[model samples]
Target: MVLNELGARINSALQALSKEPVIDDKAVDALLREICGALLESDVNVRLVHNLRQNVKKRVNLDELAASGNKRKVIQLAVFDELCSLVDPGVQPWKPRKGKPNVVMFVGLQGSGKTTSCTKLAAYYKRKGLKVGLVCADTFRAGAFDQLKQNAARAHIPYYGSYAEADPVQIAMDGVAQFKGSKFELIIVDTSGRHKQETELFAEMEQIAAAIKPDNTIFVMDGTIGQAADAQARAFKESVDIGSIIITKMDGHAKGGGAISAVAATGSPIEFIGTGEHVHDLDPFSARPFVSKMLGMGDISGLVETVKDMQLEKNEDMMKNLAKGVFTLKDMRDQLQTILKMGPLNKLMGMVPGMSPEMMQGFDADESTRRLRSYMSVFDSMTEAELNSDGKLFDTESRLRRVARGSGVRPVEIQALLHQHQQFGQIVKKMGGPKGMLGKMNPGMMQQMAKNPGAMNPNMLKQMGGMGGIQNMMKQMGGMGGIQNMMKQMMGGGDGPGGPGGMGNMQDMMAQMMNGMGGMGGLGGLGGMGGMGGGRR
Candidate 1:
């Protein structure tokens, strides 16, 4: 991940404070404000940010901590703890009932993963030794029943539905009846997603939901939808008692933030996430890792738990910030911390489909951290005029010099900070709107990143993580020490027009081949197993 503005902000603030002998309130306030801003940018909810800021401030009283015999080291620990606490770290075990077809209904607008979700859920339960059945009730959309049928067949589950029946409620009722006393113990009802706006269809949907009285209701959603999650979720939430959600197509480039996190603002929790098109990709949802990914942080709860079952409450806090467009320096800094937590810069960014190793190479983590510390110093020295007017620093050379003097960095470094901020601002603008070339810049973003040299900074990564097309697994892997060395051993370093050959066009073919396997772990032992010449993972 490129160190975009958000990461820069957090890194700068954190570094500055890390050097301090005492935890100054002034410094904390600036850092908190920076965090507040970044959280908002990520489209997080407002009240949460307000709560986060207040809580962080309350816990960061250097005088209090110091008086309590808390050392400077502990102060940083307290900071991280306070923030992590806000995110609520923990995992929820899947609590399936003892008996009966734990009736799960997957619902969402058209094209959401409802159809595929039914099959995935069925397969999950089937593996658990429960006989699962499927009922397709989508009469409005053509071929919806067929799709469900095919998926059910693939899952090796019994399915009951009729295109001939007009009443979906009857079909659902019959599905349960047919499964009764049979081998199937769990029955999933697949309903066609009719937008909440469609009165007649929605009415039928409501009737169907009522008739089934499902044990769990899952709303499937596409991941590309960003801050609009609240509105979209609110649209469907009122009609049915939404038990949970399944975020689909996350394997695609779309940011899984909104889809997986509709619960963030809507008060609904996610139950499943579609990892890929294949049968095994449906994953149970908790919240920790998904939220951690959104914040560009590590899975504090542990990787396996996050991958298996997701909810970690603090996710609610993070999502609230992203929805509101408050990308704070602190939030940026936290992401930088995440990078450190995840290892080397290039390897971290390498996991992103669009992020080239070259871009990762361009980032000098030490220099960047040092520059960020210097940047924070400059910001610290800024007068109210400069703080309110980010652009004014450009014309106010003497003032800028004063900032430089106060921060103990050269005047030019302050200028460089200003330049970085400008580039950061442009990238943010692009991210806020069409994102045009800037949006696609990270991996597919390469061509775009080339046009905008500024896109390689901290802010871009934060926003792109929101925009999608990258694997957050890299962020975690990079920070975790062993993973990097492991990945280094795993990385193919040769040339075969693909693999490590660095040929761009062949990457897709390579990606497909890689996807075929469970993961890169299998390749770790092979330094030279493939036909290519570079390093083999």
Candidate 2:
């Protein structure tokens, strides 16, 4: 089974347990059986699966908990905790310091995506304002330096490599020295891939490590390797001190559980996982959030962090407009643009609560991207006056036709965009009145929520329609039919053949949900009104 299937099976088991009228031993045993079966099918080690079952059984004593009145909660928590422990190595991965050079060395067999991961890590740090540089030390593989060079250039990260340098150790030393001398904060050294039986190559790897001591030696393991990852990880650990691990190619239909469980057994924490082939696909690994997202229980903190990275709160004009409950056509355009920058649409949707992968069926990410770009074209064709206006100026057929001709889009599409803008405008208007949610919030409180979306204040939640309001919002997004309706509206009432709408509706629905929950404070950073108005841009 793949990771998604594994998560779904485990979730189904937990839901079954939740539905049981009586939490009996039989039900608990059935739950354990289901979870263990899923894990084993996903290539998780038999021994680890047994241990997880035993641990959950020991943790949840049904008879003892019968008096607690929360037996279901206890049992579910035990399962969640054990699953987290199954993947966690209990070791903290090394972090790079800001002022000094932190060397990260990559090691794995050939075809493990080491070179790409190096560039991904560099890009990740580069986005965080760190001076990161890449070093291509893989002289063993043909065209290794070229691959690293092309990747580095695409990511715009500085790199050092040699076409003539045949000695991998020498290249590693020289590259590290050059980047360190240049005062680069994070220097990643990519070494040649080697197998366990290759004694000579292992010796060469040891020589390179001696030349330039890496602050963190990451074992880049292929997630598709299944249970064999355990032995490979142990072999690499025995050869050199592997400080951390990065499991690559996890986005596919690979049986990744075995690799993850195997690596965790080696006591080297997984620092990151390559989710896709894209240069920005490396996601920092956190055991809890990983399991939560896998179980379709959205990672709110992770979502907030992603939004924070975009620095949407820095858009002063957008924030001010939102405070006054104003969402103009230009604001909608900017939000769409920000969504385009926020990476894959499916990935974003996965971060939201109640948005399970099953609910995202038929959502085409690439098509949604094209549709968003098309909307941008329509916005570009509009005059500044129209962009700043409340979208009423486009009511004239001539004006609509002029924009449609200019943008090369159907008039219906432009009308769709205008209608979407009107919906947002109405929501913003409600938030502006004296009795509105935004009107009730103080400026300082709004700024605080904007800065840290995850840390929602209790008073803010109460003022913004409280938990009850959030529950109602969730109901609107809980079903496929609800999501389909929202998509239809955003896609201009299915104007295109077979309805071109996709996850693009998620942005609008999320914005509307935030508004319905009293104001745009909840998930506003992602909706687009800067930090606390619409949603993430």
Candidate 3:
């Protein structure tokens, strides 16, 4: 089964239990059975799934819990904890420190995406302000160095390799020495991908490791390997320390459950997962958040981290205009650009509280990306005055036609862009007036709000339609259960009544939470832009 389908099945079983009028052992057993079945079908190890079942049963005493009430909550929590345990080995993965060279070695079977993942990891660290370098030590595979070179060049990361250096060990040592001497903070050595039966290659791997003494050795496992991932992980772990694992090809219809479950065999944490082929497709993996997103609960913390990593809050002009309720076309364009930078649309949607994978089924990520790019093209063709203006300059047919001609976009598409900008402008207008939420807040509070929307006070809650209003909105979103719990966790309520800050921060929080989400394609507006014809030039 696909990973999303596995999540959906497990979620469906949980939802079924939630609907039960009476909590009973039979219902709990049914839920566990369904969940276990999903895991097994997804190629997860049977032993792990069985242990998960027994563990949940041990934690939840439905009979005793019946006396205390909230039986469902106890059972749900138990399941969540057990699922988290399946992937977490209780060992913290190695981390690279600045001002020193952190050597990271890559090892995996050929075709497990080891080379690609090396570049992705380098790119990920580079994005975080680390001076990273790549060393291709895979002399066994033809074009491996070229692949790394092209990928490194495209990502603008420094690299070290040689066509004449047939000795992989020498290459690894020379590369590490070169980068370390150059003061690169993170030096990643990509080793030749080998099989378990390749004794000489395994010996060479150990030699390379001994030569460089890497701080962290990541085992790149193919998600599609299914149950075989367990043996492969064990094999690689035996060969090296296997400080961490990075599962690749997760974006495809791979049996990711097996790869995730394989973490138990190696006793290493999954440092990252490659979601796609893009240089920015790597996601830092945390077990709880991974399962939460898989189960459609969303990862608010991950979303917050992504936003902070992008430093979206540094746009002082946009923040000032937002405070004054004056959103211009330029601001809208800037948002679209940020969204494009934030990675795939489906990935962003998964970080939202209510956007389940099932809900995302109809949204084509490629189409949405194309539409966003076309909108950008439309903005690109506009004059400086029009871009800085409130988009009303396009009211004249002549101006619209001229822009349409220049941008190769239909006039209607430009009109659609204007309409979307107008909607955002209206929302901004509501935020700035004397009676508006921003108007009531001081500059310090506004800055705090931007930094953490979940920290809003009760007065701010009243400004945004109250707790009831937020719950109603979440319900209207998809009728998916557990949104309230998700919201509470997002707000750092930690099992409090009505969550932290009374749900007042939901609207303004979501608005400021993911500037990319609110600003990108205007939430639902991107879907309505059918074809976005003639805007591709």
The number of the candidate with the highest TM-score is 2
Ranking 2 against 3 by TM-score, winner: 2
TM, every model:
0.54, 0.90, 0.86
Error of 3 at 5 (Å): 1.0
lDDT score, candidate 1:
0.52
Alpha-carbon runs more than 4 Å astray in model 3:
442-537
164-244 per-residue lDDT for model 3 (tens digits): 989999999999999989999999999998988899999999999999999999999888888888887888889899999
Q: What does candidate 2's lDDT look like per residue over 1-537, in tens digits? A: 138778888888999998999999999999999999999889998889999999999999877887898898889889988998887878888999999999999999889999999999999999988999999988889999999999999999999999987898888899999998999999999998998889898898898888899998999988888888778888888888999999888888776887887555678888898888888788888887778778866565566667667666566556666667787777777677766777876677666555545655556667777877877888899899998888889778999999989988888767666666676677677666566566666666666666666556677778767866544444543433454456444434354532455323544664553332222445532333221111211
State the lDDT at 153 in candidate 3.
Answer: 97
Candidate 3 — which pairs collide? Answer: 461-504
lDDT, candidate 1, residue 346? 34
Better of 1 and 2 by TM-score: 2
Q: CA shift at 139, candidate 1, in angstroms?
A: 1.2
- How big is the positional error of residue 496 in model 2, measured in Å on the Cα after superposition? 5.4
Model 3 residue 108 distance off true place after TM-score fit, in angstroms: 0.9
